[model samples]
Target: MPEVLFPLDSSKPFTDQEKIGHNRWHPDIPPVATIKPGTTFRADCREWFDGAINNDDSADDIRDAPLNKVHALAGPFAVEGAEPGDLLIVDIVDLGPIPQEEGSLAGQGWGYTGIFAQNNGGGFLTEQFPDAYKAVWDFQGSECTSRHIPHVKFTGIHHPGLMGTAPSAELLKKWNKREGDLIATDPHRVPALALPPEPDGAILGSLSGAEFDRVASEAARTAPPRENGGNQDIKNLTKGSRVFYPVFVPGGHLSVGDLHFSQGDGEITFCGAIEMGGYIDLHVDIIKGGMEKYGVSENAIFMPGRGGPVYSEWLAFSGTSVTLEGEQRYLDSQLAYQRAILHAIDYLTKFGYTPEQAYLLLGAAPIEGRFSGVVDIPNSCATVYLPTEIFDFDIRPGADGPTQIDPGMGAPRSANPNL
Candidate 1:
């Protein structure tokens, strides 16, 4: 019989800290269970605020919500037989929202603020909309009625906030020590000691040594981890999508938190598409050669790859450049650009297209590239766009299967070649 790993419980608030340890599994510390590839598990996830904030709650409610109590998730269940250097293929079978109180809004819209910025600009409304800005505009009113843009479709996609194997014990230990030391230091010592005497002078002494020690103790409790082992918000895993994670320790302790309903790419504002929760159905499958490549790395997920000769309404290129002062910034920018393009080409070639063919296709299409950001360290990124009308081929299918090529790869390739 299939096991009910994380059963649904509606009696408790979702974001309660005590609930995380009770509901989720950690890989390195202890083993949850061992399961075969086809084993299915159920996850009972909580709303983003664990019922702290409601849909009818105002922005003030969000601002006042406890920061630590936000973004709760369920389970780090172990897939039996999953070992190091193996991949756990997860297939999402079903996701449903458990009915809440009558006036409660359990699941709602989903999207990321960062993705919105990619399409729009990054700024508050003062900068985003300076003049004639209407706080609430009616679509059926004169302005929108005269415009050609019409409402099409809207979807709310749900995905996890945090999902990954626990870090090795050694790493966690080192993190505790380093962060612990920093937290033991006081931030207000210098100012407190340097305060000038008032005219009605009462010389205020510095904090007692014992008081300083206490301050450090409190700060240490809230210090960010010395290592990046804490919560990570990767908004890619959605309902019906599969995530392959690398296993570290036995039972591959896995923990998840931070649930968003729908989000755009980039997640710029540190907030996600929509913060809500419901139920998630997870099927854990073990794959050989999957675990060896686990953990966050440069080449893991967001590798540069050519997407198309597929059509786009408009073509645009975007990139970022980094510079070392007193050195060649432009040269570095050029090198970064080349690297990004090469990476894209390398990714595209994996789809069975010859290097030369991919290059030609990129050149023939209405491609445009531009700089994205340059202020960060080793700044870099480049995006090329090609108009959809130029190429009669599809790029979406390339993700699932091998690309089909004509007998002789050339400008006039087959319109529909058998794969």
Candidate 2:
């Protein structure tokens, strides 16, 4: 257990005190608490749904989680001695899910994974994955166990899905304008799905039923990361990772939420690996004029190692395409990489990775990528390798999965050369 920094009891659940929490990330929101540099604290946290979806939820129940009411954040816990232009260093100490059993809604001890419907039009592969789906996970110390999401049987790496300091007024204005421009460009707002503010903390960011006088929106969104660092679902930011954020506001109104029991790099599915409620043990420090020293603006993170890397052998998949050469083929990598990843993701689903689960697996698990062949005429090749040793159970190519020669693929595409 981490040392609690708030006036509240450590034994209490974070969801139990909604008033102390926050959904918006604006600098205007009142700070919950303030601490100087080198301050360490234990923060109890919640899932993206803010406790709505839970274990035993049907696929429908999970998919229905309001998209507008996205990631419910915790704390604008102000850093006392921090200021703008400086860098805020958050050293992640530890993380674990809430362990609750036998309840209409149980969390902390376990978490759930979900894929929304295409009607909502969310997620990276929303078109291919048109239906709603759900899977539950039970998290013990250091690992997550789930029979629901098949194929993976490794101990999980627990990390917060969203963590960062508050955005300044300038940044908020810029976000609104950019999002507005994007919305104007396309009404659907495909990939540039900017979160506009909505009434009610998105799920209330306050203490024990108390409401903050604000709306939850893009600035508060636990989605795209900014200089202040909101939601950059990097799976490697686990215990011992040193995260650096460029301070934008005074006291660096720091907030954290969107805890993931586990996740992969791409977070391809909008939902993510295993959405769970957990606790964060963080050590906060301020680096004077550090942002200036870095020679660039915006927030960035430095990870020493995620739960320490485990060396292992891998099963690799190759992707072939036209022209790895020249600027005209910049889009080739996108097509090639997408094909390779899809191949890998589809292959994993056979052994328990749901389309969504498999997407998450490709991200969270230690996979490597390489450019295999560039000399094959006008073709370039890439490969994404999955470590075979990561799976605790013996993982043979299951019946459900398509082998290397999946239909429409595997055959050399040398006819049109660019095909």
Best by lDDT: 2
Error of 1 at 355 (Å): 44
TM-score, cand. 2 vs. native: 0.80
Give residue 31's error in model 1 in angstroms: 6.1
Instruction: In angstroms, give how far residue 344 of model 2 lies from its true place.
Output: 1.2
lDDT of 1 by residue, 280-329 (tens): 66677766765444543211232221221223364344434433232435
By summed lDDT, which 10 consecutive residues of candidate 1 come out lowest?
A: 141-150
- 1-419 in candidate 2: lDDT tens per residue? 55665322224444456346766567767777777777788876666665677566356554466666666676877887788888888898876665434343334566666655655535656666656665666656656655554445556667777888877888887877876676677666543456556654354444223334334433445567776777877777888889888888888878787877666545655665677665688889988887898853675767654574464667888766632242345336544655677778777755544456566566545466667776665557778887787665545556654433211111111122111
Give lDDT: candidate 2, residue 357. Answer: 57
Against the reference, the lDDT scores of all candidates come to 0.39, 0.64
Q: Which residues of candidate 2, in runs, are more than 4 Å off?
A: 6-19, 99-107, 189-192, 200-220, 306-311, 320-329, 332-335, 349-383, 390-419
